[model samples]
Target: MTTALLLAVVVLGAALQRVSGMGFALVVGPLLVLLVGPVDGVLLVNLCGLLFSLLMLATTRGAVDWRRLALLAPSALVGIVPGALLLAAVSAPVLEIVVGVLVMAGMSAALLARHAPALDGRFAPVVAGAVSGAMSVTAGTSGPALAVYAVASRWDPRSFAATAQPYFVMVAAGSVTVKLLLTDARLPALGAWGYGGIAAGCVVGLFVGRALAGRLSPGRTRAVLVVVAFAGGLATAVRGVASL
Candidate 1:
């Protein structure tokens, strides 16, 4: 049952990610934490997310904005260290609470700041990248920070979507690497068949996303994403408190 649920969550997440260039973690992170334990769940999210992003990047590469990727990728590299350390130090229940709180807070901020004025200058991407990197490593959800940046910078939606893939790739890779090196955390032993299912889920999701691209509006998709994320976060937080 847990494996089945995990596959469903991954499929849903990857589809949403294809549609928005983000939201895989928003949809999958908290729920996975519930299905598995917090640490293994987050590690699985990073690993799966890396694979999904790599696949998406191949299709979106033509539309990518190199300038944005250049600004965001390296700073993200610098920010994962502390995140890995935090993961190492925290207890599972505490980490669950942290994950829940961060997800809720990040999503709220992104929703509220959608109409904010354009944020120009060099520091914007730098800050966003660093925050995103830390969040990605800590919670396996980097979209909110980058979402805020995309809106503030008045980025072209298509380009933002495309550019985000490579950025996600970098952040997820760095996150997994640092976590392995600096922390003792390991992914739950999802065997070859389990991993194969995850990969297939991503592929199916991308196909579904393409099919739905014409019929579904971005607004509706985002609305659903926010709702799912908020619910998952609330549930995880409540579970953490009860456990504590």
Candidate 2:
């Protein structure tokens, strides 16, 4: 029964990631921790995330915007080092609360803003990428930061997904590296099975999400963004409080 529940969580997490480019960790991490343990849950989610990133890259290959990614990617890389260091030192519970508050606040701001300002100028992506990278180490959900920048840049869905792809891939790699270096933390056998389930879920979800992305009107897209932002924020808050 526990094994079945874990598998179901992975599937659901993958579906969430397929639609939003993220959320697997938010959905699966906490539950996995509850069922297994924190360390095991983190390992499982990270592995699944790595596979998911590859799948997303393949699915959105042709549509990627190399230009924006080129601008933002370096900053993300730079930020990850510090983030990794911080993660090594800080307590998980504290990090969770901080991240949760930020998520909620960011969502609130985005929703309340009257106009989406232009953030595509010279330094915005760099700043956003750096922040996203740092946040990834702690929260594993830097998609909100990237999304805000993308929205400001006026990137269409394909370009947004494309530009963000490598960031996720790199962040996942950085996270796994950090985890391996810190301790003798080994991936669980059960997690290996979970990865397959998540991958299958992501594949199906991606197609559906892509189709929905095409049909969404601008207003609807904005609405979705607002909702996701709030969800991310709420997840962060819950994680944070739980840590406390």
Candidate 3:
């Protein structure tokens, strides 16, 4: 039952990511933390997120904004180190609560401020990248920060979506490295079949998302993603409090 649930989560996350270009972690991270412990589940997310981004980049490579990505990557590292330390310092229940709250706050912030002032300044990417990195490490969600940034900067949707893949790759890699160095967090102990299921899920999700690309409305997809993420985050927080 657990394995089936995990696979379902992975598949849904990947499909959303394909449709929205940045929802894999937001949709899946909190739920994974609920199913598994915070450490292992988040670690699994980083690992899988890394691969998911790589797979996405294969098709979206043409639209990447290299200069924006260059600015984002360095600051992301700045945030990652501290985020790793914080993750290492917290207890599992505390981490779960933190992840849940972050998810909720991030989503709320992204959803609420639809018309934020334009942020076309030179330093915007740096700030966005740093926040995204911290969020990625602590909660495995980078989309909300980038989403806000995209809106503020009036980034082109195609470029933003394409650029997000590589950015996610960098964030996931840095997050995993720092966690390994600064904490005892290790990859989840999901066995061979489990790993295989994850791979299959990713593939299936990408395919489904691709098929639905023209048929599914982006606004509708985003609405469903937001609802699921919010509910999952609340449940995770409740579970954390109960455990404590």
State TM-scores per candidate: 0.83, 0.84, 0.82
lDDT of 2 by residue, 54-116 (tens): 877887778777887887778887887777677778886777678668666655565456375
What's the best-to-worst order under TM-score? 2, 1, 3
Candidate 3 lDDT over 1-244, as tens digits, reads: 8778878988888887776677787566766666567777788888888888888888779989999999988898788887777767766567658767766786677667657666686698898888778877776666666766775565765577678899899889999888888877787777897788788888888887667655756466555546655765665567668778
- Name the Cα RMSD for model 2: 2.6
**Local lDDT at 116 for model 1:** 72
Candidate 2 minimal-lDDT segment of 10 residues? 105-114
Indicate which candidate wins on TM-score: 2
Against the true structure, candidate 1 reaches a TM-score of 0.83
Q: Candidate 3's error at 143, in angstroms?
A: 2.2
lDDT of 3: 0.75
lDDT of 2: 0.68
**What is the TM-score (0 to 1) of candidate 3?**
0.82
lDDT-superior candidate, 1 or 3: 1
Model 1 misplacement above 4 A: 90-116, 216-243
For candidate 1, give the lDDT of residue 217.
66
